[model samples]
Target chain A: MDSDIRLLSDLAPGQQAVISAVHADEALHQRLVALGFRIGRNVLLMRRGRWAGPLQVRLGATDVMLRRAEAGLITVRAA
Target chain B: MKRIALLGMPNTGKSTLFNRLTGSSARVANWAGVTVDLASAKILLGGHMAEMVDLPGIYDLHGFSDDEKVVRHFLEAHAIDVLAVVVNATQIERQLPLVLQARSLGLPLVLLLNMADAAKRHGMQVDTARLAARLGLPVVMISAKYGTGQAEALRVLAHSLDAALEIGPARHAALKSVLSDDVRIERETAEMMAEAVTQPLLLPEQVSDRIDRLALHPWLGLPLFFVAMLVMFQAVFWLGAPLQQGLTGLFDQLRQSALEPLAAVLPDFVRGLLLDGVYAGFVTVAAFVPLIVLFFLFMALVEDSGYLARAAFLTDALMGKLGLDGRSFVMVLMGFGCNVPAVMGTRMMRERPLRLLSMLVIPLSLCSARLQVFLFIVSAIFRPAQAPWVIFGFYVASFATMILTALLFRGRFRNTEPFVVELPPWRVPTLRQVWMRGWLEVRHFLSRATRFIVLGVIAIWLLTNLPAGATPGSVATLAGQLGTLFAPILAPIGIDEKLTVALLFGFVAKEVMIGAFAVIYGLSGDALAHEFARNMNWVQAVSFMLFTLIYTPCMSTIATIKIESRSAAFAALSVLWPLALAWFTSFVFYQGMRLFIGG
Candidate 1:
């Protein structure tokens, strides 16, 4: 179970994960936290951009498109 | 008058509700960022007048985003009798934090459950009275789009403000201390939703998921995006072009039937100024109104359908590499239709540097007006078979110019802003809503930009017509003299004296270029083509079109950039930057041609 941890950017399309941690610069993390990407929250990767673009993820009823580069800041455990 | 302000996260029909209350056509669409600035109007509430302010949407009142700052500043400057927080009934869980944050401000508050009809269709229900009792604030459910329960909502808002007016502001509670932490606020929202809302396990999100499966397919998505853009702009052009032509014809007929008879009563100078200088020049720019409205209307549909945000998601990586975001890409595509509205469209972007940089590159989009110039010149010079290729070459050149401009100035206008966007669910906008959206933007453009463009036209008219008795646009007038003065410099770029005069006319509007040539060479149609051939060869024609592709945008664009950026220096830079690029580009093309082919 501990080995299942991975960056959100690594989750393939249709994979669901629980956010483990979000580490980024202050502003980026603030935005992430504001959008409900916190520890223990479930995130479903509905789809992602081609060539490592933004990732389209759903948090509860909200869908957010976060850049892949920024998605790297979010670590999640595959569920 | 007492003031009631609307606040909520984006796309909650706050502006639509404001329109219902005030009967003012403020800009409203499904996108998250249309209301970059606030719009307000006054209405009678209870027995007195009260101002209704529609603010740019904000996720959190305490958040430090640009829209939030605008909201905070409004609160600081004006005393709000009632802060009506409008939230989508379907999005109560995520939207509740904003209402709680506003509650800490201690203002008399009314929670509006807007879009109740859509929420019911999607199987979400809000218990308004229970929520009111739990939070100690009035909660009303209303459909802003369809005006359902508007009267009830109005009555509640009036009652809340009536209570507020009886008792003045309650020391405007200390803003900093009572604010709840993010975790606590989120927990409170969850508890409130549990008590007062019934959200079905499954709603219409499945429909969006089904659509996005194909729309966001890795392989099919990019091609779909390109095709959608082509169809959209083509639709705008083909549909709006006839309307533009009709307006042009109507103006010409009006001049012929209405003004020509007055020719005998007024002096020739007054008549020329009124007819040729003012009427002709302004009408040429005015003919673009149809295209501008169509652009806003179609863009509203794309936004209302929720694909615009997905488009951003799809293109962010590529556009990011070029130092722009996917939002900039849409505006640039819009530039193919017209540059003025495209430049205006940059207001959707929040960051100043990114918006300004997008403005710098948008004018290079080879708008349809420039396409008109290229079409005539390409047909006049190149073969029928080679014509399409030559025109296509300009499209490539236009993109090359945009990329280079982006890359070159990306560092100068660099911003380290994050690119996080919320994707709203898809919904079809009503035809009346779409029509109102288009008309409001058109009215905004006409009211603000018309004065400056008319002034610029008059300035050009004076330059070409001064020194009475001198022929219009001839060697003796100021325009001709200036053209002659610039001819030697433009010579390295393959432009001559008469062509230079037309270039000057083009600054007023690109569509004026053909008429400028007819005026200068005293020819048109086939005769004009023969004269054009005698003036220069195919190479010169290519070089000239290249110059026009990147040169200074028309007067209206400059005025819009001035209005949008609010900086005269920035507007001056927009002009000088392109002028320099055009000169350098054409100079290299012409000189390089002579060196290689000795043509």
Candidate 2:
């Protein structure tokens, strides 16, 4: 696991990270942006469910639950 | 009256402020998009009557979701006098872009920093003077939940409304062009947040975050959620039982004292109509008010406390396997109380397939109406000790059926939307707000009961009493004929002619099943229980409960399904599939029990 760059799913629960880039389609990208997920935004990987379930992440004051597959599309770096 | 539209990013306390301003209790939950349609109320603002419209929350004015489209169409169609943009003060960084977008819409604006108390508690200081100057709008700080600064907010809004100014065509085009640049908009919002806000050196952990740490824990979160639900259901029964019994006794007394006296003056048939048909049927549904109130009270608390979002997070994986999301689980839980609102609740889901699948499975939940009938049968046939477990087993079976139904239809629709939902901050819900919600729903239930329950009861009464001398609820009457026609088809499931007639009326409303039994047997309470005990063995009783659990939803549910789905074919399928499934499931259960236990 590279320290400089990793997928959002790689961030351990309670780990803080900053979004570096998003690798989804245009529509998903826009939706993510509208939810306050964007470059340079600080996000905390608050919790993840078992058996590769959805991940609950806190971005700004908003907490969002995203599927692991969707989480995988976001590239993040340790804050 | 001048119109003002309340607009904001999702979950900014917009609806709460709407209720505060208009004194109208629209549904206010912590989750986003709770207000799916436009809700309007007239209020006297600064002594001038004005209509306030609370539109569904939207992320962006140019967003493509259904809620956004609704807001867009509304702004285009209605000449709103003032656009009151409610911003969550604690999340000003994320909410400012929406405020800016609404500003660009060329409408006169008043900025309301709602949840100001929560923001102050977070150690965030918002310079309203600077913000007002920066945004070129009147800014008012208020706590919608606690009703703080409401008079100031109303005064500011009235002043803004009176001095409305329309945006010039050139300025509108330029503002639109500027908003189209997403990167620049984000940059500008960040800059604005930095200038107009100050934060403490050491920020405290949010109460919501601290709770979510345990509530959303990987290993313990699910168990905790289930325990919470178990407590809720137990509380519903423990607290609701006495009140339910009292209401039932009161209605019984009314029938005996008021309606029974009418027998002397009126003809016997008319006396029977007033007492047996009208009062019995109405009380049968109305007596469940306590149970309904408790259920909604708990539901409102869980939703307003922001726990439901964590529940959604906990269950998303399991729901994903069924081709649905965790929010659908909330709707299904609501179905346990009533299928009507549960079906309507699908509006919270933005995806068509998920909404449709949720609607399809909601009818299978063991609603309180069905639960009442099940309780009657189980208590009469099984021992008191075994009654609770028997009822629990029926609920387990209902869930199994709902899951199997979802799995069977998963291939028919595409899962377009990913699981992305906001976990709103936890708040101590005000009792007034909770009670207002409960009262509103109770009012809705009474109105629906008046329309469907009364009409259905009168029709059944006429069928059983027409042809003047025919024996009531016997083969010579129309109800009996209809029951006889359906009895052979239901015979394999252990439903006899009298039970079949009751089942026919049960289609009108499941609560009517007990009342129908009372009518058919001409018995009540202990006598009715005795009749049930003599007629039904344990195996037949279990089979009958199974049939009731899986069979077609009551008439009101079907009508709601038709309206929500907007498809005649889907409604027809809703009826046919459940009937088929019920028959097959009941037949299997009855045969299996008979073989193992040796009837």
Candidate number with greatest lDDT: 2
Model 1, residue B146: displacement in angstroms? 52
Candidate 2 clashing pairs, residues 3+ apart or interchain: none
What count of clashes does model 1 give? 0
Looking at candidate 2, what is the lDDT of residue B395? 78
Categorize the docking of model 2.
Answer: acceptable
CA lDDT of B488 in candidate 2?
Answer: 72
Give the candidate number with the greatest DockQ: 2
After superposition, the stretches of candidate 1 with alpha carbons farther than 4 Å from their true spots are: B1-203, B331-359, B366-396, B411-416, B498-502, B505-545, B553-575, B588-599
Worst window of 10 by summed lDDT in candidate 1 chain B: B27-36
Which lDDT tens digits does candidate 1 get at residues B1-599? 88898888766766557767886323221223222334566788877888787776678787756566557766755677899999988888999988887887888899999989989999887888899998899899999878998999889989998888776555454432343353355457779989998642332877878888888888898779767866775676668767866887888788779877868599887776666666765665566667667767886677667777777777788888888987787788668767988999988676899999999999998876687677667767877667656766787788888889999999988875567778777766777767877677667656644655565556666777778889987779887898889977998899977778768777877767755554455444455667787778988998899998888999889999999999999999999999999999998998899888998
Docking class of 1: acceptable
Each candidate's interface RMSD, rounded to one decimal? 11.6, 10.9
